[model samples]
Target: MRYNKLDLNLLVALDALLTECNISRAGERVHLSQPAMSNALSRLRNYFGDDLLVPVGRHMERTPRAEVLREAVRDVLVRIETSVATQPEFDSRDTDRTFKLFVSDYSMEVLIPHVLAIADAMGSRAKLHLRPQSSNPARDLERGEADLLLIPGEWCSAEHPSRVLFDDELVCVVWSGSRHAQQGISIDSYATAGHVAMQPIEINEPAFEQWIQAGVGAPRDVRAAATSFAVLPFLVVGSELIATMHARLARLVEPALPIKRMAVPFPLPPIHQAMQWHKYRNLDPGLVWLRDLMIAAAQRM
Candidate 1:
């Protein structure tokens, strides 16, 4: 199909129809009346040379072709919305918008307090939903389910727009009264000790794997593993367990827990916390404001 021949407005109508499955609801979704939505659907059917959406009992079901076209259509719609919508300066004091943000538990520990404080200063009209980071954060952003994700630099995708909010080196954290606490950890001592670690999904990041593999020869025992980085500090307290984590987390957890930061026995890659969003959000005023706020919070951390 030629790109110039495609009708963008019909794509919007089709997307709404696909999602809502009812002509009235689809029209409401696009702020069109019933007749306008019906006309749009007829035009879309003619354009696509298929019913696109067929009435299935009480709801609409997609044709086989529409199923294959859904994702591409949605992508085009999102880009168009981003381009056409007037970028409004977000006024947290005036608008009560609830933003769903994808954040790791570690990010909550390090970034939430500052974010909340900022929200308070901005009159507390914005509500935040902290969600777990998805394996495909870019998809979430494209679908408009998650406004922003607090993620590591390694997860950055070339197609998305991202900015490093802050950077830190990794530190080994151990119980203050544990054997490794009083003395500096040596390669031999570090390898032999029981360790609690956060397991990274095998995305084939060489730097991270090299660091983990380096300590495998000594006492490198993976006694416990957790996906949540925030749990590592708590798990190390009063136990023989030791954890390697971002240095910023050590400072945040030290005063609260019976933990001390030990020098890493081997070198590890620096960790960068990045705020990631789809490029489509670049022109969205609300997204821009939220992204800036997230950057400021990360800097403060």
Candidate 2:
């Protein structure tokens, strides 16, 4: 369709182009051929009377105009998708909507299975795509790149609406044959033990336990670090390393792995796992149904 002598289809091309900043990658995103994408870019440049993307050394960089249009274009597309493209009513059994969610490895192991089971029991045909939690999940929610986010309560975006799904406490995990298991963990031992810590790949900050330990002025001898919480138990197995992780995750992995879980020797606050959504999607029927399903699953957990 044409609006004010401009082809509206070019907007989709422009969004992908500006976001990716690579012609080939942008073409792949929109499933267009390289030649087609190049043509779209040329037409866009002619329409806008400026080059949106220019080469910067080995990489492509967005021009000043492109930077200004980036967020505005994303907002326009999100508004159209949510307000104009969505159906007025939602029926779980009949509708086939794909819900994208950003979740931590902890939630993937302890909570997502329950959610899938509940969805199956309800005979819903909705598909779920679980993406690994990124450093900036609030940005993903704002751009409508994800339908929901499952994260710690403190990390949730204040501009959006969120509900506390469940609360979990931290626990200390050690090898079943380790000396700490036989003698039990004390504050001194916990601080002095060789620890296997978690530092997710997407984040640059310290893990939750590390922050608490820092506040208490206790330092740990971190022997190793892993990107996934699920790997912490394996790293602790057959070794003297101690891992402080979520209680629910520890319990889930304890049956199969030769690991023992004990209470943290120091005082630690509970982790409130929350579900967040874009504020603009507050009344989206599909999102409402999905949120209800998530809440029901969390209650079961």
Top TM-score model: 2
Clashing pairs in 2: none
Model 2: per-residue lDDT, tens digit, 1-301? 9999999999999999998999999999999999999999999999999899999999989999999988888888888888888888999899878999999888999999999999999899999999998889998998888999999998888899999999998898999999989999887788778999887786755447666576447767789988888889899999889998899999988999988998888787788999999888888999999999989999998
- Candidate 2 regions exceeding 4 Å error are 1-5, 215-218
lDDT of 1 at 30: 87
> Lowest lDDT 10-mer window, candidate 1?
200-209
Considering only N, C-alpha and C atoms within 3 Å, which residue pairs clash in candidate 1?
191-218, 191-219, 191-220, 192-219
TM-scores for the candidates? 0.76, 0.93
Candidate 2 local distance difference test against the native: 0.89
Model 1: per-residue lDDT, tens digit, 142-164? 77678788877777778888888
Error of 1 at 201 (Å): 8.4
